[model samples]
Target: MNDLSRGLAYTFATGLLWGGVGVFYSKGTEKKESFYGFMFLSALLFFLLTWIFAFPQGAPVREVLLVAALMFPAGLSGQLGFWTMKKALEHGPHGIGWCIVQSSMICPFLAGVLFFGDSPSAGRIAGMSLIAASLLPLSAQGVPAVREDSCSGRFLLLIFAAFLLVGLQQTLSLVPSQCPTLSAAALSWRVPLVSLVGLGWLGPVLFRKTGVRCGEIGWISLLYALLVFLGQLGIYRAIDFLGKARSSGTAYPAACGMSILFFFVYCFFKRRERLSRRALAGIGLSMAGMFLLAIS
Candidate 1:
């Protein structure tokens, strides 16, 4: 296949893997499996993958340290984002949590424009506006009357927190790219180091008294790790191809948009989750916004 085809294929694969992550997380929560166990195994597997495949060869010590420093906050934010995402999914409608987190592309896009000297075009502005508008309808969707006041409020807060944390993680991911001293390979291996450090925080939680069984979540954790590794690889390859063609903008929004669509369909059919009219309208707007963002 040509470069464009390869890039698009990788992008779509990444989207599918990401959507699968959400699906598996939702399933795990339903089973009352420990998020800590899942995250720990996933981080460990990701670290092993980096050690085997992406480790930098004889890089200068200073450069290695610099990369580690840059990745630290990114890792922390990503871990926390995942935590909030799990909590949000546990309490709210599956589609709502997934959609809000996917919409976090806006965070990195704005960061690029304001901090990295990217052009702020009309298309991008309008796309951001549409995405912002969609949030109102999404948030307005009614919850079950049983716990409407408490559960609904908490769910919204958690999802919004997940969005910001994930967005910050994406924004931080951009920083390593701008560093002249860091090679892509060097940047890659250090990713798992920071991830391990982030996962370390949950180690204490794992030791706490809980009914969560490792046996129950073992396969789920392994699957989560495998999907994450493949997704990260797909994203790296997609960017390499698309960047050369000067169409890298298509990769992020395309993957995110596709993942959101995947979740909507998967939840509707597999879980029999029906969205209200306003929520459906919000999703439509969000998709349109992503399309505009991709083109911009």
Candidate 2:
């Protein structure tokens, strides 16, 4: 396949895999399963896989240290983001929570412009505006009349926390790729290092006597780890094929947009998540914003 085709294929696969991740997360929440335990297991499994297959060889000490420094915060932010997202999903509408999480591409986009000297355009500005506007209706959807005030407030706070933490994680993940001194070999080890760091954060929970057994969710956690690993692999390959700048502009939006669509479909069919008129309008605006961001 041509480079563009390869990039598109990888992007599409990443979207599908990430969409599956969200679906599984929602399922685990619905079942009142130990999502943290599942995450801990998945992180261990992911680390093992990356160590075996993607570990770098003979990398410079400085570059390895750089990857460690960046990925430490990235891993911590990612775990914190997952925690908030789990809370948000448990209390709020599935579509709304997932949509906000997927829309976090805006964070890195803005970071690129503000910190990395990426030029912003009119379309991107408008796109960001629409995304911001969409949150109004999305937040409203989370605050139905049947729910208590405290519950509503908690849900909104969790949602906002998820958005910020996930965005920060994504922004941090982008930095290693942008660094000019890092080689592909040096960067290859980042996946394993990040997974290792995530395991550190989950260590207390995983080591507790009352912790959920791996056998309880073994197959599911395995699937989750596989999906996450493959999704990251797809993202890296897409960037390689399309280049950092082009991939940042195109691949991220395509993956996120497709994941949102997939989540909506899953919610509609399986969870019976019917959207209010306002929610539908918000989704429309968010999709339009993603499109504009992609082209900009």
Best model per TM-score? 2
Question: What is candidate 2's lDDT per residue for 1-27, written digit by digit as tens?
Answer: 766668767877888888988887776
Q: Each candidate: what lDDT? A: 0.69, 0.73
lDDT of 2 at 224: 82
Steric overlap count per candidate: 0, 0
Off by over 4 Å in 1: 1-9, 142-151, 210-214, 237-251
Residue pairs with backbone overlap in model 2: none
lDDT of 1 by residue, 108-218 (tens): 666656765555678867876777677667655422232343347788799889999988876676665555567766656454556466456356456764433568777
Evaluated against the true structure, the overall lDDT of model 1 is: 0.69
The TM-score of predicted model 2 comes to 0.85
TM-score of each: 0.82, 0.85
